[model samples]
Target: MQALTRPYGALHCRVDGPSDAPAVIFANSLGTDLRLWDPVLPLLPHTLRYIRYDKQGHGLSTLGGGTDISDHADDAIALIESLADKPVFFVGLSIGGLIAQTVASRRPDLVRAVVLSNTAARLGTVESWQARIEAVVGHGLEHIADAVMERWFAPAFRAKPELALWRNMLTRTPAAGYIAACRALSKADQSAATAALRLPALAIAGDTDGASPAELVEATAALIPGATFHIVPGTGHLPCVENPTAYAAILSPFLKAHAHD
Candidate 1:
C-alpha cells in the first residue's frame, strides 16, 4: 500500500501494472474500501496501470470532517495528478460513481473514460438516506451494517460464508464516517451533471440490485450520450464480488477498447 497526503486527509492506495501504461483508477462503494476490488484487479490486462484507493475514513485512510462528493472528487484528482503521468480511465461504484462523475465533469482533461457500476444519479430517497444517517449516528454502523449487507447481496449470497466475511468488513467501519457519507449521499444530485458528460462512459448494474435497479441504470446510461449499459446476471449491488467473471467480461473489453495506446 502507498500513502499520499491531500488537503483533506491522508489516502491509502495500491497500484499495479506498469507506470508507462495508461492508468485505470478504482474507487470503491460506500462503507467498503479498496479491498472490494480484490477479486477483479488481477483479471485486468497488465498493459494498463491500475490504481485502487480507500476513501477517506475507510480502510487505512484517515477520517476527515466536511466530506462531500466534491471533496471526494478533489481527493481523486489530487491522487491521480500526483501518481500517474498519463490520463486515466476512472472506474467507480455506488457513491464512488458520483465522485467520478464530479471529477470528470470538473476536470475533463484528467479523465480518459469512465466505468460506473451499480450506481445512480440520485442515489435514493432523501428520507431513506436521512434515516440511515440518524441510525448510524445514534446507534453506530453495526446497527445498520446488516441491513446494508442484506441490500447489497442477493438472498443466496447472504447465505454463503464469504458473505459473512464481507459483513465483518462492514461491521468495522467507523460509525461517524459512515454517517458523514450518508449525509453526503443525501445531498448529492448528479442527474444533470451526469447527463451532460461527453466522454465515453459505461454504466453497469446488477439485475437484482435494489439500490440501483435496471431501470435506474438504463436511465443513467441514457443520460450519457452513447453510453454502454450491461446487467450482470444473478448479482445484486456488488457484482464485482458476486459475479466477478461476468463483471470482468464486460469490463475488460470496454477498458481495452478505450485505453490509450
Candidate 2:
C-alpha cells in the first residue's frame, strides 16, 4: 500500500521480489487496479522484481487531473524512474496497453520491452466513447457493469460466484476517473508510434475477447518490425485473470529472453 506522491496526487504502488533483480512493471486495464496482475505474478519467475500500481483515480490513487493517455504514461514513467535502477519490461492490458506504447515511444530508455494484452493501436471511436461516457456520467458504473463483465470475461467465468467480485470492482471505480480514461481512449491512436518502436514487443490476445479481437491484436503486432503475438484459448479480454497459466506461459519466456538486454 505504498504511494508515490506527484503534483496531481499520490499513486498507489507495490513492489515485490529482490531489489537488485531486473524489473517488470505492470499496467492494468481500465476499471481494474494493481490486483489485476495478482494471479499472473506468482506464476512468473520470482527472480525479477515486479512493480504494480493503480492508475490515477482507478484504485486508491487520486485522479490528479489526468485527461489523456500521455498523462497516464507520465505516471508510469515516474514510477520507473523512481523505483528501478535500469530499463524494465513494461506489460500493459487494455487501456494500459496504450500507455505502454506511449511510454516506449516517449522514453525508450526506461523500457526494455513491451507486452500489449487485449488492446489495439486505436480502441473504439469518438462517438462510441462519448456514448459510453454519457452512460456512466448519467447512470453510473453499475449501469454498464454487466455489459462490461460480458466483454471482460468468458461466459463460463460470468456464471461463477467469483464473478461478483470482479463486477463489484468495476462498479466501485470512481465515475470521474473512469470517464477521464474514456476521454483519453477516445483521442488516442498509436498506430504510427507503435510501428516505429524498435524495442522488443509481445502482443497477447484472448480468443473470445469482444473488446479487442484476436485479429485486431495480431494486426497491431504486425505493425512492429519484429513483435511476437499469441492468443490464449477460450478466454475473454482478461486472459491473465481467467487463464493465468497460459498467460504466464506466453509472458515468462519473453521476459526471460529480454531480461539481460
Candidate 3:
C-alpha cells in the first residue's frame, strides 16, 4: 500500500495497469474502502492505469475529522496531484460518487471524466441523517449494519455467505468516521454545481437500489447537459460489487470512447 499524507491524513493508495496510460481513480462509499472496486478492476483493460484508495478513516488511512463533502473531494484531488500530472476518469459509488461530483465541480482540470454509480445530488434530509448520527454515536456501527446491507444489495445477494464479509466491513468501521461521513452527506447538496459541469459525465444506477434508485440516478444524469445514464438490473445500491460483469460492460466502453488514448 502506498501512502500520501498531504491535504488530508495519510491516504492508502494503489496504482495498477500501465504507468504511462491514462489514469482511472476510484473512491469507495461510506463504511467501505478501496476493496470495493476489486472485482471490477481486473475485468477492465489493463492498458490504462487504475488508482484505488481508502478514504481517510475508511481503510488503512487516518481520519481527517472533516465534516463536509469538499474535504473528501480535496482528499481525492490531493491524491491525483501527488501521483501524476494529468486528467483522471473518476469513478465512485454512493458517497464516493458524491466525491466525484464535488471534485469535478471544484477541479475540472484534474478530471478527465466521471462515472457516478448509485449516488445522488442530495442523499437524505438533515433530520434523517441526524437521527442516524444519534443512533451510531449512541449504539454503534453494528446497530445499523443490517439496514445498510439491505439497502445496498439485492435480497439474493444478502442471502449468500459473502454478505457476512460486507457486514464485517461495515461493523469494523470506526464510529467517528462513519458519523463524520454521514454528516458530510447530510449537508451536501450538489444539484447546482453538478448541473453546471460540462465535462463528460455518466450516471449509473441499480434498478433495485433503495438508497438511490434508477429514477433518482436518472434525474441526476439529466442535470448534466450531455451526460449518459445506464441502469444495472436486479442490483441495488452497490452494483459494482453485486454484478461487476454488468458494471464493467457499461464502464469499459465509456472509458474506451472517452478516456482511453
Candidate 4:
C-alpha cells in the first residue's frame, strides 16, 4: 500500500518478497487495479520481488489528463526507475500488455523480458472504442459491466458465486478513468514495436478468452522472434484470476529460465 509520486499524479504500488531479489513487475488490465494480480502473486516464486501498481486513473491513482497507452507506459517507466535498480521481468494483462510492449520498446535497458497475457498489440478499432466510451459516458459503467464480465471469465467461473466480486469492481470504476483508458486502447498499435524486441518474451492466452482470443495472442507472440505462446484451458481473458494455479504453472518456468538473464 505505497504510493509513488509521478509527473501526472501518484501511483499506488505494492511490493512483496525479498527486497534484493530479482524483480518482477506486473501491470494490470483496464478497469482493474493492482489487486488484479493478487491471486497470482502468492503462487509465484518466493525468491523474486514482485511489484504491482495501479495505473493512472485506476485504483487510487489520479488521471491527470493521461490520454494514451504511452502515457501509461511513462508511469511504468518511472515506477521501474524509482524502485528496481536492475532490469525486471514485466508481465502485463490486456491494456497492461500494451503498456509492457511500449516500455520494452522504448526502454529495453529496464526490462529483461516480458510476459503478455490475454492481449494483443492492437486491440479494438477507434470506432468500437468510441462507441464504448459513449456508452459509459451516457449510461455509466453499470451499463456495460455485465458484458465485461462475460469477456473476463469463462461461463463456469461466472456461474460461481465469486463472479459478483469482479462485476462490482468493473461497475465501480470511475467513468472518466475507464474512458481515458479506452481512448488509449483505441489508438495503440504495437505490432512493429513488439516485433523489434530481442529480449525473452512469453505470451499467454486463455483458450476461451473473448476479448483477446488465443489466436490473436498467438499472432502477437509470433511477431516476436522467439516469444513462447501458451494457452490455458477453461479460462477467459483473466486466467490469472479464473485459475491462478494453471496460470502460475505456465508463468513459473518462464521466470526461472529468465531469472539470471
State each model's C-alpha RMSD to the native.
1.2, 0.6, 1.1, 0.7
What's the CA RMSD of model 3 in angstroms?
Answer: 1.1
TM-score of every prediction relative to native: 0.97, 0.99, 0.97, 0.99
Candidate 1 ranges beyond 4 A from true positions: none
Best by lDDT: 2
State the lDDT of candidate 4 residue by residue for 1-261, as single tens digits.
Answer: 799998777889998889888899999898998889889888999999999998888888888665798899999999999889899999999999999999999999999999999999999799999999999989999999999998999999999998998888888778899999999999999999998999999999998898999999999999999899999999999999999999999999999999997
Cα error of candidate 1 at position 66, Å: 4.8
Residues 1-261 of candidate 2: C-alpha lDDT, one tens digit per residue: 799998887999999999999999999888999999988999999899999999998989999766799999999999999999999999999999999999999999999999999999999999999999999989999999999999999999889898899999899989999999999999999999999999999999999998899999999999998999999998999999999999999999999999998
lDDT of 3 by residue, 1-261 (tens): 798985555889999988788899998988998889888888997788999998877888888865899888889998899776689999988889899999999998899899989998888789999999999989999899899999999998999999999999999988888888999989999999998998888899999998888998899989998999999989998899999999999999999888643
Cα lDDT over the full model 2: 0.94
The local distance difference test score of each candidate is 0.86, 0.94, 0.89, 0.93
Off by over 4 Å in 2: none
Superposition TM-score, candidate 4 onto the true structure: 0.99
Worst 10-residue stretch by lDDT in candidate 4? Answer: 58-67
lDDT per residue (tens digit) for residues 55-90 in model 1: 888888887762578778888998899888877999
Off by over 4 Å in 3: none
**How do all the candidates rank in terms of TM-score, highest first?**
2, 4, 3, 1
Worst 10 residues of 2 by lDDT: 58-67
